[model samples]
Target chain A: MKNKGDIFVISAPSGTGKTTLVRLLLSRFPTLSFSISYTTRLPRPGEVNGQHYFFVSEKEFKKSIAKGEMLEWAKVYGHYYGTPLTFVQEKIAAGKDIVLDIDIQGAQAVKKKMPEAILIFLIPPSWNELQRRIISRSSDSPEEIKKRLEAAKKEILAAREFDYIVINDVLEDALKELVSIIQATKARANKRWPEIKRLLQA
Target chain B: MKNKGDIFVISAPSGTGKTTLVRLLLSRFPTLSFSISYTTRLPRPGEVNGQHYFFVSEKEFKKSIAKGEMLEWAKVYGHYYGTPLTFVQEKIAAGKDIVLDIDIQGAQAVKKKMPEAILIFLIPPSWNELQRRIISRSSDSPEEIKKRLEAAKKEILAAREFDYIVINDVLEDALKELVSIIQATKARANKRWPEIKRLLQA
Candidate 1:
């Protein structure tokens, strides 16, 4: 039998450049799968139905939660968001490593449901750097920027709970660390058991 | 305070090309320290006193073992070989990572004495390939080759107990995997706790 794949859950505070890092990681590892979340919110102009998210009506989303189909669900700004259990299970069973980019709360929820999931937390170099990144986004008002900085502080404290931490000091360096973590996981004894057995018998 | 460095214990069966991979790894990572072993056996031609092996008399070796200064020691072919504990401790305390290349029995002993030591086992790709490599060494007689192959089989079985297993198939690929394991260990939560604390306070 093929060895089961690993599930990596990545979480970071706002303005930490988590999205950019995750995008680069996925692009580099073609075989690695990305876990798409189910959302009740309407898709943006560029978002695809299945590729971006499994967009569903509020009624359908609630039905899935009641049926226990959602692996982890949360309501934010009156819109429901969650991971579907079946997709992750099927991919992992087929030996496909999957990456999930979510918030700290979502990461905790995923860990509770799937204890095998590896949780990684990303952070900026310093509080000042985080504030600079947030304020530089002209789209946010001063009040929104202030609120984001406050949230970033609380999220930074949760870094202690993560299995691994990647400091986003230089984009290239952070990417290297992230890649190393993924590659190292594949060398775990449990994951390489099948090959070990074959060699022994041969 | 600086984070205490990690102890990496690498074990491999005979003819696995472990020596080449380890030498390359040390050259690539200049900051990593190699744990020099003490041996009662006389040094081979051109071997340096301190750089190759700490050549000492049986009296000195036994005294160190009695004082519990030896981390792990074994008597092979009527000669004593062992690792010194104080050197390892001092290097780690000074925030320097150390690598120990030894046999499976030595690796197990180090793990028992230092529970945090990471044990990595290296193996050849296949049984046939292993035999080919061993026979290619013209120095060994047929009887000696047969004995060595038996020992290799026993060591291969011990790979299951290791924390990581690296297959020495292609030299370059194996080196990359070994390097990734070292880099990933540095990102463990406990190692990065100090940085996380500074970020939280900031």
Candidate 2:
């Protein structure tokens, strides 16, 4: 019974309700934990240490990057954010399934290091809804939002590389699909064949 | 919103509860349909014409093989058993999820033809339990039991090629896993990406 914590790498374009879905998953699946990212960006209002991010200085962040401690990192909105490999590995060792709330680049980096990780791309049901949501939830200006949407084209293309693509049409349906994927991934032959063989021997 | 029938190819050694699990799946998910296999074998005591198998003459079976109408076919216990391609294709076209109860060889054949099919292999929790179930059921004599056990060895070895290997340790657990697998397979990125992209374009 090898019950190792498996990482779920979630990638989504802006305005796909990725954050809300992540929170919903946290509430729905008790076994899941979030992988807090390390960033050089200053915390926004109401953001707390270790809750939102592990804020670090430019020099410290760069040092971590140089040491290859980051599973995936990128400079966005003139700030750096990345998943720390050490923290994720530690949580997995503690038998907690961790969600990597990352962009495509970060997801790819994690996949390269851990081939067993499940990569899921969250998709907005329609472009009109996506644009509407992005505008409505503007933590960014119109100009900034345009830039993010432009970047999204490139990000959405990466969905083709993911192991699963979840349509964020309805929150409940998407969440149900996500949990089912976790359960089903665990039942994969590569994961369970050994146990079955051992049972035969016993 | 395209609802393509997701396909699950399930294989198991004899007496591993595959039949029971599949029965539960059919009743549990109204959207699913089990592929009816065409066979040349004379029906066993209680088997029906289209339920246990779609009985056909040896000539008809060979003709189907020549016409490439069988998805997969093999000789078993001196008779031919095969899945009819048209039956599976029709159900899928009609948007009914399809489950093919097959051996590993049949699963491999189907997978080669349909690259997207999800393969699930079922196993008993232990050899002792499997043996007990088979012997206690008293379906065969001691000599026949030995042969079936030997065949089980060869069949279980082939489980490695499957996508998921579920242990029927408890029927409830195995059935839950099977249901989860069918749901999750539809979420595979390769299967969903194009549709997601199209929805976004709309």
Candidate 3:
């Protein structure tokens, strides 16, 4: 029998460096897997069927949600996005740590279903820095950038509920802290109990 | 204002190599300090005052306990041993991580008073290994060894309440895990909030 690996539910407002941190972490922890989300939106060019996301019809997504197979789902810009419950459960049961990069609302949903999931909120150094990062990316319009900045303010307030709040001030330091948190979780009492017992009895 | 360092409350049954692990950990982390307990028992020859323990009269120990200066105190074999609250508090406030090598009961007491304290329980590789270690010490009487073995069983039950459990299967692996746990605690959200703010604002 395999011990279930812990889940890391990471959330951050746009420009908190969450994407970069996750990418770096994945590279470092080769055993770690990223949760492949399901989306109703049509796949853009170069997006694989099950790599970037699981592209599904709205009807299929709704059917899975009704069957309680979606861990967390949300609607964005008239498109549906959701995390498949089985994907996370299977990976964890097979002893593979999966990182879920979700929003605050999705994070809350995952926490409610799997209270054992480690909730990490990534925060930028300051509001101004976050705003500057968003603007510098040049991916959003003036109005969209303003809306995201406003949303970041509200999201920062919810960081209090997270198990760990990683400050993305310096990329290296934040990444190190993230690594520490993950390593520590793997050594938690519940996860180590079986090994401890076997060690004590051997 | 100084950010308080994290506290580690470590408990292990006799013969689990807790002492050696703590010693190695201290050497690795220069900022970590071991808590010196105030003992009413007579100091053995070669045991230096204040270095091994603060040899104190029973009356002096009781007085300190009454004044709420003792973080956790207990009587073993008709002698009183207590951890001084001020010593630990001062060290932590000075940004020094403090390790409390106490029994399960004392660990519980410390946890109650300092809710943020991280509790770790160390487990031996095997029952035979634990027995071998205790016997190899050649200090305990036959009856004393038997009594200790019984206590170890009870101590293992309390491992459930601890935050992390390090299994001493291989000395190197256990020591590394211990270090990771301490480093992770220092990087906890509450402890790192200040540094994160400074980094972000820099």
Candidate 4:
């Protein structure tokens, strides 16, 4: 059998540049497919329907959830969001590496279901830098920023559970580290055993 | 305290060109220190003492082993060879990465003492290629070549116990994979945790 593609679950606090790092990885590794999450929330400006997320009706999202289509789904701010297992399975069967940008809860859920999934945690260089990044976004009020900083603290503490943690000090360095992790994971003994076996027989 | 250097134990069969790959790696990464083994066997012509091996007397080698200085030692063809643990510890304390070229038995011995050591197995692309390479050496008689091939088979079987198996198909590709593995290993959570902790506090 051909080697199965790896499922990479990346998690980070909101201001840690997780999305940017994943985007850079996708650009560099064309074989990787970015998982499109399903969300019940309204689409924001400049967000494409399928590219950003699969914006679904709350009823439809719940229906799919009830049908057990979602690999992992969670509610946030009174809206539901999830990753579709079927899409991920299909991509993996086609030998495409899948990158999932999710929160810690979602990452844990994915891991529970697929023990082979690689969990990566992205974090800001420092708490001060994280605060600076959150403030620079200018999308949140002072109170909201305070709440996010508190959440970031809890998230950073949870990083010990991750397989790899990429510190986003410099964007270039973080990207390189992320890329290396992905490359090395694919070359792991468990994943490449079939090829090794064939070589032995040859 | 500074980050302790990583001990990388690289093992391969007779014909995989593992030495060439390691030489290329050392040239590329100056931070890595090639571990010089202590050998009781007399040095071959052109082999430098301290550079190639310590070239100690059998009595001195036994004394060191009795004193618990050897990290991993083996007797092959009635000649005793070993790695000096004290020298390795000194270099590690000084934060210099050490690369050990050893056999599976030596690797296992080192791992028993230092569980954190990374073991890498380098393999040929195919058995046919391995046979071809071994034959090309032309130093051994036909019967000797047959015995060497038998040993190679056993060594390849032992690769499953290693942390990583690098397939030496193309020289450049294998080098890149080796580099990526080392880079990713240093970025692993356990090794990078202190820096991450400092970053969080900062």
Number of the top lDDT candidate: 1
Q: Single out the weakest 10-residue window by summed lDDT for candidate 4 chain B.
A: B193-202
Candidate 1 residue-wise lDDT, B11-63, digit = tens:
99889999899999999999999999999999999999899899999999999
- CA shift of B152, model 3, Å: 1.3
The segments of candidate 3 whose C-alpha lies over 4 angstroms from its true place after superposition are: A194-202, B1-3, B44-46, B93-96, B139-143, B187-202
Instruction: Order the candidates by lDDT, highest first.
Output: 1, 4, 2, 3
TM-score of each: 0.96, 0.92, 0.90, 0.97
Clashing residue pairs in candidate 3 (N, C-alpha, C atoms within 3 angstroms): A199-B125
Cα lDDT of model 3 by residue, A83-144, tens digit: 99999999999999999999999999999999999999898877678888989986878998
Candidate 2's TM-score on the B chain? 0.91
lDDT of 1 by residue, A87-176 (tens): 999999999999998889999998898888888999899888888888886488889888888888988888788889989999989999
Q: What is the lDDT of candidate 2?
A: 0.87
lDDT of each: 0.91, 0.87, 0.87, 0.90
Residue B130 of candidate 1: its Cα lDDT?
93
* Model 2 chain B: ten consecutive residues of lowest lDDT: B193-202
Off by over 4 Å in 4: none
**lDDT (tens digit, per residue) of candidate 2 on A13-124:** 8889899999989888878889899999999999998998999998999999999998889999799998898988898887678998998888998899899899999988
Candidate 1 CA-lDDT value: 0.91
Better candidate by lDDT, 3 or 4: 4
User: In candidate 4, what are the lDDT values of residues B1-202, reduced to their tens digit?
Assistant: 7889899889899889988999999999999999999998998999999998999999999999999999999999899989999888998889888999998899988989999988888999889999999999859999999999999998888788888888899999898888888888887878878878877776
Residue-by-residue lDDT tens digits, candidate 3, B72-128: 999998999999999999999898889999988999999999998999998887788
| Clash list (residue pairs), candidate 2 | A189-B164, A189-B165
Off by over 4 Å in 1: A138-143
Model 1, chain B only, scores a TM-score of 0.97
